[model samples]
Target chain A: MKKILLALSLVMIGIAYHNNVKAQSEEELVQICTMVAGDAEYLKDFRIKLDAGDPPPVQRFPVVLKKDVKYRFSVCNSKDYEGKVILQLFDNNRQLATTYIVATGKDYPYIDWVCTKTGAYHLVYSFRDGKAGLAVGLLSMVGTM
Target chain B: MIKHRVILYQALIIVLLSQVLSSCSFCSRQDVDLSQELIVPDSVIQNSTPQVSKAITDQMMQNISSPVETAALIKGLKIPFNKNFLASTKQADWFNTNFEKAFALGLYGCDLGYLNMYEKTSFVVDYISVIKRLADDIQVGQFFDFSTLKRLATNNENLDSLILISQQSFNRIDTYLSETNRSMLSAVIVTGVWVEGAYLSSRVAQISNHPKIRETIGEQKVILNFLLALLKVYDNDPSMAKLITDFEPIKKLYDQVHITYELGEPEMIEENGVVTFKQTDKQVIEMDDELYNKLITNIQELRSNLLKL
Candidate 1:
């Protein structure tokens, strides 16, 4: 009985500690996201918490991009998580830009896109290795083209 | 019996150890419920329309342009700020319903943004007071930092902070409303902001006929689709249904404005570890004076009708 109770308490402590760390990382993500916004006019923000399936489907959000508007997409990921986020800007199925380059294995903190067409665009986020992660992203208007 | 009890205890220990390992600082891929990722909470569905998904609603809300940007663009045209363009705060007492209050709150917010942009600190007090009252009526008043805003509004040097804080307050309001399954109010508030901003831009374009202002006014055609879609999401509500009917004429007017985009090579420039993609593509707004005039007239007329509510 004593050993059983000890094991139960240990499990509870582990879960609580894990949750505490996650909450702290998410708070830090918001601050880093704001810092990434720099001098641009802050428009919209996405705070995403993802626990993916085996295949890890892309988490997508829609934004209406305007013509002649230069917009910035900035992302700050939680270092506590194993997953590194890949942020992509898509016009339907066609990829317009991305924060990570698969061939070069390079990553950027942000990507700036000068939208020439006024229409709906998708911001697709996914983890590098189909892992669970938490991230915050910002959409800011850089200036008019 | 003792042997069996020992085996049971050992099994329990194994289960506990596995849980602890799974809950370690680094998460593994044991959880795989994709259905959990896409759906809105059952609580949210209970309070509002059930058909629209949270993602669609989120997109709808994001599509609405921030009034701060509109005010800044108008200010950039170098036109003299017109106090007449703002909705009257005296009408605050007349609004009793949540629909009226939410819409009026948006109207006052846009006015506040314009005042903040032009650094008209004195005019901000009245708008802020009315907005606080309206927000309180809707039970979202706690989001606004009234005392801080009041202090900042009194000082011209704090205009930027005032604008940022004010925008943040509205954002908090939207977030609170959405989380509480009252996102319909959030949609209504943004609609109010869009109407007022379009009205301000239209009125200015009439006087100055600034090409930039005209182009901005023409750009409303794109935003209008998003606004209409958001309203349609809640059209089952009688008030929202009426608002959609009200916008039909303006929508018809905007339909005449045609925009075409020509493809060009995108230029990538890297500066100080930052990359910027500059679009060389050009967009042409093809609208004659007749249609532009009609659109402006209808927008002004609709805005006047909405303010009366």
Candidate 2:
């Protein structure tokens, strides 16, 4: 019985330690994602951890966007990450609609687009520089007009 | 006698070490058969960064299907909530086991979003209670601020607040599950939501000839494939095995779907000194009516297996 108890206690300790690291990463993700989400109602967030590179590979999220429906796209990068992230929105025909990375100085916080056509669209994101970073991408609907 | 005690202690330590290694894989799965070990390496899981095909990457990017977004879209289209498509909250208690509760949590999450979208305040309470109950049962109850959620649901007018709070609630739950190494629950909960959402979408598409809805269902072929791969990570569990069995044909149906890509010239625009670039890649999906009917049938079939279990 004593041996059994010892084993059980060790297992608990291991689990507790594992949870601590996971929690810290998640906390960072939530804080960053909330910034991109802004005042718009939160929908979901994608947490990306970049490996060392000139440019981290782009991440893509596909959703069915409707015509005349306004949607919000935002990005939040970790402080340690070397640079910002650029988010691009593409229509079914592969036409770029509103892209945050290319809009002006490549430092805009988010994209608020009123989709003119309805179909499948991709929300693509990548770190501005490949210096290995952690970032969160957020998506929300601003309600239809 | 002391020597025997030492030997037993050493054996116990070995057993405990194995448990420690596998615990997060579903450490406390009392009722689940443990004959098959959960075997997934950290390196193989692309949960943090998916470098797969665009189809597979989009599916993983979702991580959790946006039933709430779907609800919003339906509302934007001026469609009424077809309560018939939703699983009943009355069945909440029927999901007594961990697997059942986790799966049902996904199902009810869909119902809750639909209810919130329609501003069906009165119906939200029972669903919230059931969701709380399931979350509590799974030991992730702390993530859901039930009282605050209930208060938000009761107001009826703070639609935006309610949406935000609810999104935060699920976000917290998912994060806690990930943080605490309860990824199995996360997997099932996500699968449950995806299955329910797909089921709802497929059913709605059947009732109406909405092109967008049909396209949505067709597009799910990509997601369904990725979902199957995620399930393979847990294929050792009996419940997961059953799920894998149920979802196989759905995968085969989706295998028939072919999406073609046509890349157009990229355009760069300068507006008010803001530089924006547009992707010129267009995709054309070819799926026949027979395949569509088969796809709906398989999607519904998958959900039916989920709920019936």
Q: What is the DockQ of each candidate?
A: 0.33, 0.18
Q: Candidate 2, residue B23: CA error in Å?
A: 23
Candidate number achieving the greatest lDDT relative to the actual structure: 1
- The residue ranges of model 1 lying beyond 4 angstroms of the native Cα positions read A1-27, A52-55, B1-54
lDDT of 2 at B286: 73
Quality of candidate 2 docking, DockQ: 0.18
Q: B180-228 in candidate 2: lDDT tens per residue?
A: 6666666688788888878877877877787767776776765555566
Alpha-carbon deviation at B43 in model 1, angstroms: 31
Instruction: Provide the lDDT at B48 for model 1.
Output: 28
Q: List the residue pairs that clash in candidate 1.
A: none
> Stretches of candidate 2 above 4 Å error?
A1-40, A46-71, A76-106, A112-137, A142-145, B1-64, B265-280
Per-candidate alpha-carbon RMSD to the true structure: 7.0, 9.6
List of clashing residue pairs for candidate 2 = A54-A130, A93-B282, A94-B281, A96-B278, A102-B275, A103-B275, A104-B274, A104-B275, B23-B27, B264-B280
Give fnat (model 1).
0.28
lDDT of 2 at A50: 46
